[model samples]
Target chain A: MSTIRIAQLSCGTEYSGVQFEIESAARAVGAKIVYPDVSYSQVKEALDRFGFKPKSTQLQLMIARAMSLADRKFEADAVFITTCFRCAEAALVRNELRRFIQENTRLPVVTYSFTERLKAAQLLTRMEALVTIVTRKELLARERQSGITAGIDSGSSTTKAVIMENNKIIGKDWTPSGAVVVETAEQVLANAMKEAGVEMKDIEAMGTTGYGRFTVGKHFNCKLIQEELTVNSKGAVWLANRQRGEATIIDIGGMDNKAITVRDGIPDNFTMGGICAGASGRFLQMTANRLKIDIQDLGAMAVKGNWANAKMNSYCSVFGIQDLVTSLGEGKKFEDVAAAACHSVAEQVYEQQLQEIDVRHPIIEVGGTSLISGLVKAVGEVLGEEPIVPPHSQYIGAVGGALLSSGFL
Target chain B: MKVFIDPPNSMVLFDLVERFGHEPLSSMAVIQEKIDNIEVDMPPMNVTLDDVVRGLKYAGVEVPSGIRGRMSLWGPMIEAADAAIIIDNAPFSFGCVGCDRSNELTKYLIHRRGIPALTVKYPTDEAEAKIMVGQIKDFLGGLKQ
Candidate 1:
């Protein structure tokens, strides 16, 4: 098969020196970044279409390139629109071109505002998502799991393996993240298979996901190695039995957080990243350590506490812990402090990440943090609706991999 | 050599460019000329409908007239620039070039002109300010007079 070409439409990439980072990100996913060619005449024609001439020739060229994509003049599987973060005109042009391309072409589109300090690491996930959309469209469209499949989620804090047969989870196992990612995956997969009373040869297909997906997938020769955004949403909606309609899936992970909106089981819009660990499960772990309670018990205690009595700062984790210590110093109840920590993380996720997606009914909260009743309560309270933390929510990535990979089998 | 400064009204960049031995094409000087000349437009309004029409050469008619007016004044400086210095993420107090469209267009033109241009983020603290100044100084020193 030919390489997928993602058309580059933007201004100031070379000036900002982020063009190399963008290229590096694209290359990492085995895809190529192509700048669509346009003639001077085509640029002039495109300027008329905008009903306003831009003073910058680069902006003019961007519009022309977007026009080329819209006219099917370029053979591209996806579109990436980028501009320097400081350029407001480029921002306007970027949004307009994004809308124009989406309206005119069947191609998937992603937009980013890059600074001079932009890195390949920052662009990798976006590039990967674009590549996934291009390469796994049919696979993503599959509605249900069929046949027996095994999936492993190699996460930052824990590794989870799940075995699914005909849309039902037959077996699952999870362990704290170990030193060797592949060994951890192998151990979890073996344990899960043992629980299912099935040998390796009985599994028709295998899939992997999460941060260590590539490493684990390569070692196991898995059929699908996918990013967690899509995988988690697939698993959350499947577990919640909300596969038919609009639903938002929120996964507060150990390192970061993801909020995705699904339409009929397919992710239409998603936002990931928490700007700080203060908004993720890591903070909860710290809270558990501070309270001298098992991580599992803190959640139940948090529900009984009044968050209003022991408010913590939502912006920084350090400040949050400081508040916790201050609250404890002031003789605030442990349950109240625990509740405050859960509420703080929930509020930060709402303020920072949840604003990116339009909130919908039956919000499905997944991930290891979802197992914490207090955190779930905090999310429900912050969102003003009780979220469904479906059974096996923590194994979402593994289940998503199993469900999606079942299509291949 | 003419040097164009983004936030075209920034007196700081204007003074720095002049101190570095380049003619700074400041929007203040250009607007001052327009304000002094009564033949083209009325007082306070500075630019006439003709200037706005001329601005169509730079931006689309769908864009606000404010952007077109600013573009008309800055476009020539961009076209004539031998080099440029753009300060990104500047506060509104730094130099209130209120029109985003014109600011973007000006920077784009300077970059597309293939001139020696130095783009720097606004320094948040004193240490970064020192570093930014050093960068600007080095870039200016390397420019061919």
Candidate 2:
């Protein structure tokens, strides 16, 4: 495949001395940054035609370049609009240019506001996402698994592995994530292979995902290494049997949470971030440890409990656990305390994430937390609709990898 | 009725106001007038001495020429607005409005204009976008045409 040309549309990148960071980020992903060529006359014409006067000549050129891209005067695979964070006018123009390009072309667009302190590492993920959108459009479009494949998820809290043959999950295994990412991945993959009674040679293609995807992918020389947003949403819809319709996917992981809205198995919109771990699986693990029960059994305990009796704060994980301690010390029932923890997590997810999506029917909940009946129940109760917690929800990343990697086979 | 939107050239607020049957008083339109008036020899350097004097009424002489130049367009739009919608905490990309002093002065002028102004947070997702649109619809519908 040829190198993707991402049209750079921005102001002050050169002046702020961060142009090299942008170039290096694109180069790291096997892409090249191309500036849309604009003449002085074209700049003047664009300034006159755009109907907004910017004080900087660079801004005028930026407008003209955006017009050039929109007019098909420049050919590129994607568009990256950027401006300094300090420039309010540049911010407005950057957004306007992004909207203009999206309206005028089918090109994928990613916009950023950078500071002088910007690093190439900060821009790598955005560049990689753009490259994925451009290079893997066909792989992303594949709806089902084909041939024999395996997937590994080197997650933050736990590592998971899955093996599939001809669209069916043959075997899977999961364990607590280890200090050494590659060793943990190797063990999980070996365990899963043993369960499936297949040799490593039997697996035709392999894929890796999660936080340590790049490190593990490099170690294993996998066929696909993808970001969790697209891969997880794909795996989720595939597992829930909602490939043909619109559905919302919710994944509450150890450190962060994701809420994505998908249409026909392709993710059109997604929001992933957590201000605190209060809304993640790690918080629940803390809650279970405090209660002196097995993490797996906390869900059943919470089911028999009523959350209203032990209201807890859902803002910070530290404070949330503090509230749990107080509730338990105040002679609150263990069941109620457990239920409140589940309710607190559910409420936080609703407040923080669910509001970010239009929320289609049949929400498919996937993630390690999905197996906890209390969390699943709370999510359903808070959403006012039961989410379909598909089988093997904890191995979503691994399953998604296997499902997507099979397309390459 | 002319509706003013802060960041003065936001396409989203402009389209929403226009879609509901009102003129969106914005810098783009004001700039369009200056750009299209071919009587001025220079195309974009349309800020006249008279325009600079008008801008001084909104901002101080200590302010940057960029702010003063922008106020020349935004000041008139704010004065001409029958109603205004000001989006708060809008992401930099939503409408850059680059000059901080100019943005603050513009918002102050719009608030002091005493029109029925609606202030809203910029929606981060589709659900919030829907709610924002509904709020705009209600605010516009309440106006006595």
> What are the chain A TM-scores for all the models, listed individually?
0.86, 0.78
- Give the Å error, residue B83, model 2: 12
Candidate 1 lDDT over A106-215, as tens digits, reads 77676677789999988787688778877887888777899999999999999999999998899999999898999999899999999999999999999899889989
Who wins the TM-score comparison? Answer: 1
Residue pairs with backbone atoms closer than 3 Å in model 1 (clashes)? A52-B60, A53-B59, A53-B60
CAPRI band of model 2?
Answer: incorrect
Residue range B6-125, candidate 2, lDDT tens digits: 768788888888899888887777778888864675546587745664554454333456776778888888888899998877877777677665775577567556788898989989
| Local lDDT at A251 for model 2 | 93
Q: Count the backbone clashes (under 3 Å) in each candidate.
A: 3, 7
Once superposed on the true structure, which residue ranges of model 1 sit more than 4 Å away at CA? A36-75, A84-106, A358-362, B1-145
Query: What share of the reference contacts survives in each candidate?
Result: 0.04, 0.00
Output DockQ, candidate 2. 0.03
lDDT of 2 by residue, A91-139 (tens): 5466456656766787767667778998998777667767887788878
DockQ of every model listed? 0.03, 0.03
Model 2 off-target regions past 4 Å?
Answer: A7-23, A33-76, A79-119, A303-311, A350-362, A380-386, B1-145
True contacts kept of 1: 0.04
* Per-residue C-alpha lDDT of model 1 across residues B1-145, encoded as one tens digit per residue: 7888888999888888888888998889888988876566566758876576456556544446777677788888889888889898899788867876677667756755778888899999999999888887888888888
